[model samples]
Target: MNVADKNLARVGSDELAANSPDTRTRHGKLVSPVITLAHGGGGKAMRDLIDDVFIEAFSNPTLNTLEDQARFQLSDLARYGDRLAMTTDSYVIDPIFFPGGDIGKLAICGTVNDLAVGGATPLYLTCAMIIEEGMQVSTLRQIVKSMADTAKAAGVFIVTGDTKVVGRSSCDKIFINTAGIGVIHQDFKLGADKAQDGDHILVNGYLGDHGAAILNARGDMHLTSPIESDCAPLHELIQTLLTAAPNTRFIRDATRGGIASVLNEIAAASKCAIEIHETKTPIRQEVKGFCEILGLDPLYLANEGKLVAVVPANESQAALSAMRDHPLGKYSADIGSVLPGGRAGRVHMQTSFGGKRIVDMLVGEQLPRIC
Candidate 1:
């Protein structure tokens, strides 16, 4: 086994402790094994949850950084003059299978999309499976195969993996965690903190389809339509944009918090004011109607296949054209631009009728399990 595989094995063994259980001599106090609501509530309770679940599942030197992200050293691409790009994410969408894809497919595509939007050529991935005790083995096999197929289609490999079975109630059904590595050309320096005055904001396709599709699967809603999740792998689109405009300021895929959250994060990171046009954002008619009826803002709903690109005015058209040619970005549009001066990192939206309003992150998530 290679370093990644060996490190993964050490982490697994650490968590599993002994092959057979010795309850009489078990170490530690009677901390409840039944997961508590406080586990998800952000606090020490949450920290304990991370320790018992995430850390125990995938502990390693790289992840020991404990930062919101991981940093590592790599010189594998010296020949191509590229800088290494790395990112990790976990998928726990309730309904594993939905309109556009299942959890297996989403896990691979989502991680790849993150690196792709960051201007990286996605290469390798690590997948970890959290399976519920009563989950059918046949179903598990199907999901794993689906994941393998998606990775193959994306030209990436599942280089390493870890699996664990929890009590049925301990998790929804199944959750997947993915870590990815990619190579970014040395000349490319895209980041959320790089937006500048007059920078254009563009999105590749209509938003909220993924969230809506998942909601529909819940069976609690009283509506139905042909709307499906726009889950797609975006590495190809990223490559096209990179080939056409290697100098993009920033690139991002709107996932859990949606486009609005992504834009807010970018603004805060770059310390710039953003002004977006309400009329310019592209939304499918059915998605618009569904949001209105459900009292949800499409802006805050999740999306898996859409991307936000910030580019210089000179290269905006070229970027848009390149994105539009891709099957996943046929509906690309310029939704907004950077403002010169205002509340640093604040976002403003211009209503079609000519009024400006502040757009803030959703107080609480509008939709849950929308990876």
Candidate 2:
């Protein structure tokens, strides 16, 4: 079997230990069949759990200190920029593991994206886990390793964290909280209110994949198709857009409330009218079918990898070219524009049928338990 398949099966069988250091007994392969309250009782079990599962996977000089806080020299921070950017988020997605990623990956990317949307250079992260009593130790190990792997790939460090365990049903299998730290150059400026008249709106890639993937993974509808969560880190893509379109006004990652919600916020904040064309929105064929069958609007669906960018009309082509060149933004498109001579604080989409309708704030989440 492939390495990924083997790791996925390791939670039920121990044979994969031959090729995996994570399966070794010293790294949290405990004698107990499942985790218990004692794992969080502040004793030897807790220490062993932290040392084996977390410290082993996220080994770094800063975290290795094992102190209450992580310290950095002011000079070290100044190397990247004159200002600092910070963001915190919690992931409580049900069924921690999904088609394209898990809660661990989501936690890391979600935290990093929050900072990156503002043109920050991501650097460090803090992971806090809340685990349930009956969770499998092997499963927890897999999750922690996923977090570590994602953080390393995103050029950030999981420097410190805390852990807690509760009753069997007190929480889901696991919940992760993360805080991200990054540096912002003094020249870079972006905000929700920065959008201006005649600005063009752009998206990194296809939207609504995460929500559809999570709903299908749950098997509540007794239906299935090849839909996977579009979970990814987009700091690199944002940097590329900023380089090409230095006059870009604002950027926002489309997450829980989806692109529709983000556009509404931008319009309201900028006090302008925004218009998007349905023909220009990039969406997968599978996602289109999934939404059509469920009477759902893809515009309001959640997305983990998509982002909205507002760029000036003169620089729109340059920004789109830069985004298309990036791996994460292979499907980038200019979908809309801020209307001129209007500050209605409204967002509307020009329909494929040649009409328009107001796209307002999502009153409530269409999908719950989504990161």
Candidate 3:
């Protein structure tokens, strides 16, 4: 028997759903208005939800086979690189749907970027969903479609996945977890400890847009602005930058604690001092205004599509130029550099007012559940 047949074997639809007539059709699509516990009961109802939702959205030869695990040819993996890279992330952002992206997009971007920052080209992903029983099927379908579209755009595939339904109060609505695998070229190497003194620091584009957008989306402050989450895949941009500056020392997605946190981590790891110029930092004025009003510092805000790169001083120009040419990095800038002669893990910022201040680790979260 084929894998798809095996996945639905041992029980005919009539035998599996003797008590739940009319809940599904021949292809195992749910006709119910909303999700129910039976959808996760490992029977015809469960198969119906999978066929109607996940299998339909992420249809591919490997996934359509409905096997429990995704298989790959060893030669295909070796064709890309000498080493394998893998990363996993879960998305539990409070508001599932947001201005620039939803939970689905955030999950894909987060996992993909985690691999990209380490110089990996993402290939395959596994998705797992925990859906609330009372949630609308339409909402679930929408999120799945978003994930499939984003994966395709990023040049990756969702090859395997699992689904579950829980009590209405157990899960907020839906939460998604994604695990990705990628390959790193034989010659590629990257690490925070690899940062060298005199290396120039660069950022792809504006910071704090994702943080500001999420905060505004929650409606806690009751304010409005034109900010949207900067959630996006970074592998392509990273590849372009590497081609221009092959000696790049390190790259990190400025996610939860923002660039301030990334710099501190880099300094501590490399045992070097670093400094940044506020005048050169790229931040949207609206985000700055949002931070000012909330008594927050834009430096510590989260970012989904931003990264901190350390490139040798000689190649910084090439790196900046390459990033600027990419669709996602038109505002790329050289924000700072690793300072010389003080290797005590210190990071400082030169404010626009010509005053110097220490840039330290974020003590507490400025925002919670922000991917």
Candidate 4:
């Protein structure tokens, strides 16, 4: 089967497992219904908790060994790629559960995307959680199940993890930190500073759904919409793009600071200017309406599943085609291009109303703890 077909098959299996009543029932019986301080005391209570909740859910030959550190065979890793890419990220978004995903899903996809954008095939992840005392065990189980399902769909393993509990008010209900390892083929080279003049700028799909969905889910705005977080794993999508446009300059997931921040960083690093058309940028109608109501610019909003790629102008169509063929990038668009020298370290956007304006890095946080 083709790459997309294989990816879809895995996703389908993951969804079945995620939605199965048997899976939920099994997880429910693994631990106490509510977590207490003893679970983190590093004693018998901790051992039982680990075995029942984490180990039971994330079972694999490597993790089953339960070593302090996971060991992989060098020969096994060498077959995949020569270089290893490592990334770490923390997820603490409010309302733990959001429209499209939860903290668990965010932790997995965020780390995987970090590796994928660097031309790496993500391989393994380390999950570390800090749970507030008195948190519901069912909540933890659900999050762990989500993580396991995501890892399975992405073809990665959760090889190691740690759990800690703090005072009831010491932290949010829970916080998750994930570190990922990936393998980059020796033939590929990618970097932010590699952007050059005449390169085309592309985004995988609609932007800012995660930010808008989270804000709405919080209910503080007293507004509601069908917007959902665009959380997803993009390793397969990246692989497809790389196969189509081997000379692509750089790829970055539009995460915390959105595409605007990523573009500004690229411009500064490559000492080049970028020009994008506002009309070309894709934003969901719901997200656009939500942002408009709040007087917020969607360009500055965060995206969980979206990515910005800089590719040679000659390969722009090929790259766009590859993205459009992928499930995660159906709304992909060619947003802009890198300008020739003379306007170094600047980003300009052509307004929908036929005006041009500079797009700069955000002065301050527009949304806090947005993951």
User: Clashing pairs in model 3?
Assistant: none
TM accuracy, model 2: 0.91
Q: What are the candidates' C-alpha RMSDs?
A: 10.2, 7.9, 8.4, 4.9
Sorted by lDDT (best first), the order is: 3, 4, 2, 1
Write down the lDDT of every candidate, Cα atoms only. Answer: 0.75, 0.84, 0.86, 0.86
Error of 2 at 90 (Å): 0.5
Off by over 4 Å in 3: 1-26
**Candidate 3 global TM-score:** 0.92
Q: Which stretches in model 4 have alpha-carbon errors above 4 Å?
A: 1-31
Clashing pairs in 1: none
Q: RMSD to the native, candidate 2?
A: 7.9
Tens digits of per-residue lDDT, candidate 4, 1-371, equal: 23664465345433422332221222223356788998999977787888888978887666666667777666655655688899999999998999899999999999999998998778789999999999998898899999999988888878788899999899999999999987777767999999988999999889999999999999988775788899999988888898889898999999888899999999999999999999999988888889889999898999999999999999999989988998998999999999986488899999999999999998899999999
| Residue pairs whose backbone atoms clash in candidate 2 | none
Q: Estimate candidate 3's alpha-carbon lDDT, on a 0 to 1 scale.
A: 0.86
Model 1 residue 360 CA deviation (Å) reads: 1.0
What would the C-alpha RMSD of candidate 4 be, to one decimal place? 4.9
- Model 2 agreement with the true structure over 124-202: per-residue lDDT tens digits: 7999989999999889989999998998787787877999999988998899999998887666899999888899999
Query: Which parts of model 2 have CA positions greater than 4 angstroms off?
Result: 1-29
The digit string of per-residue lDDT tens for model 1 on 279-364 reads 99998888889899899888888998988889888889998998898888899999999998767989989998999988897788
